[model samples]
Target: MSLQHFSHQHPLVFIASHGHEIEKVNCSACGELVSGSSFGCVECGFYLHKQCVEAPAEMNHPFHRNHNLNLFTRNPYLAGTIICDFSRKTCENFVYHYSCNLDFHIKCALFSHSIAEKKNVEFQDISRIDPSINTGNVTEELKKAECFACRKPLLDSIYFSPNCGFYLHAKCVDLPAEINHLFHQEHPLFLQFNSQRLSCKICQKPQGPEFVYCCSPCKFALHIQCATIPTKINQPFHRKHPLILQSVDECLPCQICQETTNLNDFVYFCSICKFVLHIRCVSSPLIIEDKLHHEHSFTLFPRQVLYCDACGTLGNYVPYICSTCGIFVHKNCISVPRVIKFYRHQHRIPHTYFLDQNESEPWECRFCLEEVNTEHGSYFCSKCNYIVHVKCATKNSRWYYEVDSTETEEATDSDEPVDLREIHPHNLILSGDIRDFKQCHGCLLPIDTSYCYCSQCDFFLHKACAALRAKKHIWFHYCQKLLKLTSGCIFQCCMCKYFTSGFAYTCDKCKERFCLRCSLLSDMPKCEGHEHRLRRFTGESKELCRGCGTSVHAFICKPCNFNLDWNCITLPLKTQHSFDVHLLNSLITLMITIIQEVIIVIFVKRKGIPNIGFIIV
Candidate 1:
């Protein structure tokens, strides 16, 4: 259970001695055999634990399964829940019966099935054929078994249960009662195992239906409930009030005593008066339908006034609101969905809110990329021009959007595009036919051939870019606000320490993840490239490179020892320098007149001149 660089393919690997014996088993995932090597792969029934065939396949999940699943086994006789034809929601789908006891991630246990393994791990030789493979040669006929599927104790990693006397923990028998959840796949899952009191659409409280997903077609449900949520909550009819997730769309009055908005769409208020209320009054399945905003389906408005294109203000309470196209909200503003994967937009952007300005000049929100308007409240995208607020569209479902469904995509020698194996280096190809159509140049979003592309550079990327994360910036450190990830093995280039590829930019406050080939690597950095304006000094590094003074790492003027790297410390303050004049920033007034003409030619050639240094040269 401790082991983790990562490996667990059914191969829990044990050998045994005490005269205790079941004798043999096979199939960590297509190993086949199992008549007494115990069981797995009948036609791909797949089950394991002679030590899980030898573990080490791949993992990273949540209720949001986009890809990153490969590990299967289970003798068949199923029980389901693998739903993700692409965000319909149901644990993001990944479950196997004879094996995956309750875990998931093999494309949610066979979505279209056939998960690209390609073939590699094949090294046999326990001792040629079988001293019984190990525990053999000494048997009283051994057969104490007991795990048709949860009978328990087949001892260290076993799984006999396709139907019978019992024995699974071979880690709970590839656990697949049914699951296709990367955030609810079209819904069609099962496994109640009793425990159903229900209640909590979200905090109404009282759970236990095992873990919770349910959907008998569309009754719709979910519950893991309680990981941590209590920033501010108190409702004895508002109780003097104390609320703050800020950005309240309208004027700012009825947050309780501040008073102003009254009619409807006003989620969590009373900062002073507007007095809005209704996250479900308290919470419960009151109409939802979100595949990260697949066009429209949010209804809950109890009072909704109208204004709030994102945050101009007007609407009042009960607002999980959609108003069709205009904009009017407040239904607890959405939120929740993360399981590993992030490049920024391979189709993982939930927890939304907005609906007003609609976009004319100012715009930004492509799922928390930021910069929006309407007084500071937005989330528009009637289908992409973008707009965001509700604190940049409610981030923190834990983040996962790694989309790289490739056909061929590459581009490095500095044209900028770390790696986009399946359209999502923040996506930006635009044309078409990367092997029959692909697109997602960062939210332009669209794809059709299964995906993972970027072979040479036509471009493509999708498994959500393996969950991009970079907002941990370090222009010179202590600035933060990063976020731009995709995946890795190395990643150090906020602008050029090398070791990079596949874009990056993370920072939830400061785990710091940089990479984007160092944020542009240089058109201006040599020794803090000083034309002026660089602060902070903490310790001391000498500093020097204004393009080629030599000794610089990136941003460090501390009064002009200067230094700039990370791609010239994020260049582009404004540059055109040619065709229509746009070079601004005067390069420190041309490096102070070339150090004032070399200090007046060394003060008149050291006074008294060698012929006055030829009349000051």
Candidate 2:
């Protein structure tokens, strides 16, 4: 029958059936090899598949819901390159396009529509195909093969065809052709192969050459599992509000784990309560039964709390509580070690909830030289009366090590009398007597007790300072080279920035020096004035010290707006001033008070004191 189509100018003839002889001729509409039933114009050598010829001019495609896709005989883009969203193959002739720059081949659009409508008969139940029907070798070969769609091993149920060599996971075959995900709301994600091998935004894992839902323009991709996460979920801990999946750039803390979400791009957020949760923490257990941490199981306390009794840190929304002990704690703090040995102390310290206040003054933390709160948990040693804040003691793994409770406690190296003749040239005798005016040659700090005295040379070294190794690595130094212990030469300490002739750790390569006191400073220094740990200030701008009101390089607690200069940080707890008969308490406070009084006196004298001068009492 002679037929005339809008795509061609001349009349065409319909061929009911054609063999391989006519397969070489391409279809004018679909641009695929034309065979079987088709219409052809002999003079123009133009042909169209019967199905392609019958395709509608414009249709509502399931893949793109916002706009109707219109059939196009030529490339619609200025670049003249159109690739089908579904098949990911170049569409040379006929294509379906929407206003949003989405394109699809005629066959691909029809195939996806059939699949979405659940009318594709080619999708068969994988269980119906029995591997036993074939030989063991063929069954083994099939087992070793991976699904063509996801590129994952086909261990689970999959759609397979032996003749076509097509293998696809059942879930991959059912994936949506296009989806509007919360992670990339600017553009719709299309199911495509990971040809560029981009990393998944959700999991932060590199993607293999597998099927991934991707936004090509933004280069955003997500795995099938990550992309299919529910938009809203009702967690047991946060039963009042359903958390919605959102992409946020701001630094927010996760309610479940109480950790900053800066490293994560996507989080589950509750708009009503402003509660945020890490995607991985959505499945946190409601009850924890760790016997090593405690004898009783801890139940989830799903409410805002002021503080955690275990670590004494500010609490968040989701903390676990022990009903038996009446203690609320963070999930991560449940496994805090019972006993630990700090590098700064000689004796093993045990965790204690409360310290006895029988002493005249508040116990001080030896690590940071800050007053330790007797109420909160802390690491205490009964033998040495040494105490440290729980957060400070366990801040760095290199500074402390967990000790087995059952293991025998060995005498510390400081306790054993060491012959330092090799390094000091004098025989040093260990003494525990309080020397009134003796100073440690190693640290240059006054030796109160437990020091090695050399009466022959009038030199002394604190027991702890005497054990200083010849070479060591200071954690805070930018240059990681080992520092050598050197004496006799005066140099400015890189950490405290003070010039002293005392023993110092010198790095020849970096030309940096650190005094004995500053070399022992931990990475995170806890201050009594602030609840948070103090970090070394690295900004170029001047920061005023909270203690003395002077701008100097200092340790800063950013959250608390606290800055402490090196002089204030290393101030002795007790100092003997020539003006006072008794020992003065808190040298930092005393020095600042004296300085303020002197400033007031200088200002009065500068303004010219009146003739009626006060008489001395």
User: TM-score for all predictions?
Assistant: 0.19, 0.50
User: Model 2: which ten-residue window has the lowest total lDDT?
Assistant: 608-617
Write model 1 residue lDDT over 1-617, tens digit each, in one string: 22211323332322232123332433444333334333233344334534333333544332223334444433222566543222223432123321223343333233212111311122111112122244653233224543322322343353322232112333333344455543346765443321233543333445432334455445444443221233356654446666432235564343222234333333465657646543434454457776553356666554435454334444443355565764544443332221212222222222234343334665544433334554534434343343334433334333333223332322211224334443233444333343433443222133443445555564554444332332222333233234444443333343344332344565556656555434433322443334665432222354565655666444454445555543445443432222333233244334433553565556546563343222100
| Least well predicted 10-residue stretch by lDDT in candidate 1 | 118-127
lDDT accuracy of residue 499 in candidate 1: 32
Prediction-by-prediction clash tally: 194, 0
Task: Give the per-residue lDDT digits (tens) of candidate 2, residues 1-617.
Answer: 97777777888788887666766898888777787889898678888888877788897754344457898888888886887655556888888886666777887766556655667575553333434453453567577877656666665554455443355556766777888887688998987655556799886789764568887668888988788878788876678878888766678878767777774467898767778888888778889988865788988886767777777776556788999999887777787788987765666788878765489787766655556767667898888787877878788786788888779987443233233664488788899997355557676655677998887887788898788876766756645456777886545577666555678878889789998777767545777656887766644676899899999878877657788887677665544443554344345335644653565455446667543332100
Off by over 4 Å in 1: 1-328, 333-371, 375-388, 391-393, 397-617
